[model samples]
Target: MHDESEVAVLRYGHRPGRDDRMTTHVGLTARALGADRVIFPDNASQSEETVEDITGRFGGQFAVERTAALDGTISEWEGVIVHLTMYGERIQDVEAEVRRAHRDEPVLVVVGGEKVPFEVYEAADWNVGVTNQPHSEVAGLAVFLDRLFEGRELEQEWPDADRRVLPQASGKRVVDADAFGDGDDPGGTDADGGANDVTE
Candidate 1:
């Protein structure tokens, strides 16, 4: 359960695929990591569920708003603002907005997407290839929030590489025959380059 305090999270991606399952995942992950309130900045016309829906699913603990306005100081916010996608022509404006938000508060800006211009990269705190990579992204977000709230620099380096894929086991040899559940199991491949048929 999250505390009643507010944690601001700004998501800039507005396209359908951009805010698809990844956006929902981000919201759920933030709540699970202890964010009482999440402020999502939708800079496009694509709308997701309303704030009411978000609050209902999250126990009335989250807020979602759509706007292009970047006025006011973001230092008033208690948490970080992460950008899931980058803007096209208004890249400079986005950087300016993030800077304003970071001014007086410990902020964490995630730079994802392909159009990450040199300027934006120079301004961002951390950069990662895949924003939709849930596990690491969520954990990094949680760490950033904790560090920001604690008023300390992140004790580690910025996450700069793409999500690493683990090697899959070939499973060439069967360890136990009885472990297989009752089903039409596909037999292992034979050395003759053909499927081994399983017959009664």
Candidate 2:
């Protein structure tokens, strides 16, 4: 199995009103899609809190951290730095090479939230573009992660969740830990429905 922790995401240049929601989605997507952690280098506290809440409720080892010096952080990260941009090599063409090269090393995927500096482009070990067109950063990140994990992320089990959503064709059907049979209950709920409280 590919260790999701091998991949991390860095959201650079966060602006308050402008990039708030987008940056939050970037961090959430990174965690949900199988990244070890996310680094918000421009002080996205709200986003950090939301991600923390989600991880706390759902049970994940994923992490989120805020910092001010993104360039300096990237400079010190002991892994490959991949910047997602529109002006770089196509993701499909370079993903294979990237996987082979970083097979045994960690990967830090950089997603820009605002106008990026020229130094960022130079700092990256690989500048990858999902498409050479205007697109959502969230979409690019999801696609990149999907490619990197080769769809394994979709099958990942959330063992710590109090309530889990079952795959459905239409309507929503969430399975609380209390609903499962003894052997099936990963959360070890009792017959009295001793499941963890589903918080807001």
Candidate 3:
């Protein structure tokens, strides 16, 4: 439905111990949900590694980066900046407009933590709220991307994947990409607890 114009996610503010998994999910969500890349805060190297590791096994062209210049990144960003917040304008009202604008330009989506600085609100081309209520940034981001792509991401194929999940009506089943031969599923990573969908 759209041309390639790069959709990137930037996570702002992080408390190492408190936000470890939350921050990691932000990157993972971005990668799985069709964003081209995710940029983590400088102190989030561990999160970067975790996201990269997932991409390696599950497969995609997703990239993970870390930056110390967050403020500058937003202020100097070349394309639209969307900041997700509970206090912002409702997402349903603005997603169509955001989608049109993003068609020809890169979109940098900002997901903040407990307290986003005032400058972010001002710098944003759009201050969007998935729901104007309390919730996780990961939820907000996931919903936003699904809407942005109009559910096309669910049909996305992962290239160069070492493993992939075969959808089942009941129990989980994962398979090695190359080992499926003669109608036999000889390889399995689901034993390692890898499933056929996004990690929750």
Candidate 4:
């Protein structure tokens, strides 16, 4: 359902119960941070539902999918593969190259849930680390995507949204996203990698 060349997230792992919220945030981060889609393991149905439900209300073309062959998805990706891991090359050293490559090919971003298999490291075109320090994969992914887009994702406009948040110095206020009838604006979100102050 997607073109071979697009920026997508491959949620490489999931641990039931223990990781439900985390896994769900991974998908949400992928959407809010500029990925076109996220591929989850078939067993992560709850996370998938929550992410999709938010998308339905917030409005965007972000896609959430499931696959049984997570490894095959990596092996068969038609474009560049990026695996985010603390052990890999620092993002500072390679964001330019990855961003340049992304202009020409699809990018599959892999975020690990537990201990990632070694083969995933070998298959990646670039194994990126936001920092050498240990941190949450959600934090790592957010940093990388921000650098990848050079911060353009922050200004993302959500079209066809049910609500639009007004940025304010204080207090919360929301307006219908379709108030303008263009379906091209929305409230900034508190969801995942969204711009801060969703309803100020």
Candidate 5:
């Protein structure tokens, strides 16, 4: 089994209002996609408590940190650093090599919200691009993570989750642990024999 904690993300920028939502989504995506943690620089607008709340509600023992020295932190990390950028080498070409080279070490993937510095590229053990076109950072991170895990991330189970969404053909079903049990097949159909909407 692959250790999801071996992979981490560094969100390089976080501007209020503009980047608050995007950055929060970045952290959430990373957590959902099996990343161990996300580090936000001191310039970030989101609070550590908010991230803590997310992890508490979700089901991972994930971590979130705010740092003042982004470069210094990267330099001190005892692992390979991979910077995602459109200007970098194609992901398909470099991803395999990067995985092989750092198979035993942790990986720190950097996603920038603003124009990254030249030094960051130089500091990266591998600079990879999902696509050489303008794209959403959230999408790029998701794709890169999916590729890195070879789709195994999707199969992960949140054993500690207080709530979970049951698979349905149509409509939505959210089950709270407090209101359901293992033998209880809470999934029910509507009058049309299709998935029914369950409201609190």
Candidate 6:
């Protein structure tokens, strides 16, 4: 059984890009933030196996839910974390649920590449990047949860806009921040240092 105290992460992302990259990032985020449940509000592009691969490593401590189903029931847990991946989707209903769940309970949102005007995300207690390379993508999500658990409001950068995910480059590209040991462009080093001599 997983501890109920961890943050509840509601993940939203493209299913096509479901790979070790995403799973590793989210797993690390959950571990860092004490997240116990991973809820999928929408079925974007991942399968059950994908979710398993993502959250299965942390002693299998995280629970996975496909969606939110409840009548007049909101915020049954301590907090609600929403992940909005697509550009056109709206968070009005999800926000309503969070508001209803706990007037005092905090609401944290992580937005993906979808282009949403400020007005839509302004109401969130905290906002973070869902598309940021490597583990930083969910770093804000972890911090916000930490604050809420401590009875504090979220304060985030809410970057000017979402960053788009691009196709992998052919050479010396630092595509993942965490893949190379957690730093901005950690030089072309792999987890095992197997591909360190490739030319730019």
- Writing each residue's lDDT as its tens digit, candidate 3 over 120-198 gives 9999999998889998899999999999888887878788887766776876566777753334455543445444234
Question: Once model 2 is optimally superposed onto the true structure by TM-score, how far is the C-alpha of residue 6 displaced, in angstroms?
Answer: 1.6
Q: Among all windows of ten consecutive residues in candidate 4, which has the lowest summed lDDT? A: 191-200
After best superposition, candidate 4 residue 182: deviation in angstroms?
12
Name the best candidate (by lDDT): 3
lDDT for position 160 in model 3: 82
- Superposition TM-score, candidate 6 onto the true structure: 0.40
Candidate 4 ranges beyond 4 A from true positions: 1-5, 180-200
Q: By lDDT, rank the candidates, best first.
A: 3, 4, 2, 5, 6, 1
lDDT of 4 by residue, 1-200 (tens): 12325889988888878888888888888899888999998789989998898888788889999999999999999999999999999899999999899888989999998889999999999999888889799899999888888887888878777776666587655566666455443443334344541221
lDDT of each: 0.39, 0.78, 0.85, 0.84, 0.75, 0.40
**lDDT (C-alpha) at residue 34 in model 1:** 46
Question: If both were scored by TM-score, which would come out higher, candidate 2 or candidate 3?
Answer: 3
User: Which scores greater on lDDT, model 2 or model 4?
Assistant: 4
TM-score of 3: 0.91
Candidate 4 matches the true fold with a TM-score of: 0.87
Candidate number with the higher TM-score (1 or 4): 4
RMSD list, candidates in order: 14.4, 5.5, 2.4, 4.5, 5.2, 12.7
Instruction: Report the C-alpha lDDT of model 5 over 127-165, residue by residue, as the tens digit.
Output: 888999988898899998888877888888765655556
Q: Estimate each model's TM-score.
A: 0.40, 0.86, 0.91, 0.87, 0.84, 0.40
Task: Report residue 131 deviation for candidate 6 (angstroms).
Answer: 15
Clashing pairs in 1: 55-60
Q: Which candidate, 1 or 5, would have the higher TM-score against the true structure?
A: 5
Considering every candidate listed, which one attains the maximal TM-score?
A: 3
Off by over 4 Å in 5: 1-5, 45-50, 178-200
Shift of residue 106 alpha carbon in model 5, Å:
0.3
Candidate 2: residue 58 lDDT (0-100): 66
